[model samples]
Target: MPSPFPITLFAAPNTLCQTLTLTHERELSALKKAHSTELQTLVARIENTSLSTPNISTTSRTSRDLKRKREEKPDQDRAS
Candidate 1:
């Protein structure tokens, strides 16, 4: 069968244009689905890792040694 419209027609409702639109829509939808799935997986991994960690304490024995070192800096500068 032949097209009812002339061969020069390039407007909407034409088979060539309609096919191109449908193909593009399908590709765009698939890309969106893939991006969402990847985002969800990364979020879950981060949540699990954060929950399994321990709290860091600032009042340990190492901190006391560092405090003594910091206080001696001004005295050493006066001698220089």
Candidate 2:
């Protein structure tokens, strides 16, 4: 006579494994939501700072000057 109880016992570990996997997936989803919220808050803070400050053009002007210098310099190694 084959015992059916051994089959049930073998299946119990698979059930436990599925439950733990679901718990971990839920925890990861929660952490991802929290991080997204934090990133949004930081971005909003940066935007507010940029709007409030008046003298932030110095950095932009430097980059523009560098671009102009590159554009004015002719290609010296061109083979005509």
- The whole-model lDDT of each prediction reads 0.82, 0.85
After superposition, candidate 2 runs with Cα above 4 Å error: 1-11, 58-80
TM-scores for every candidate against the unseen true structure: 0.51, 0.56
Of candidate 1, the 10-residue stretch with the lowest lDDT total is 53-62
Tens digits of per-residue lDDT, candidate 1, 12-75, equal: 5678788988999999999999999999999999898877754345446568779888999899
Q: Which residue runs does candidate 1 get wrong by more than 4 Å?
A: 1-13, 55-80
19: Cα error in model 2, Å: 0.6
Candidate 2 residue lDDT tens string, 1-80: 98876554555788989988999999999999999999999999999998888665887898899988787665533533
For every model in order, what is the number of clashing pairs? 0, 0
User: How much is the lDDT of residue 76 in candidate 2?
Assistant: 38
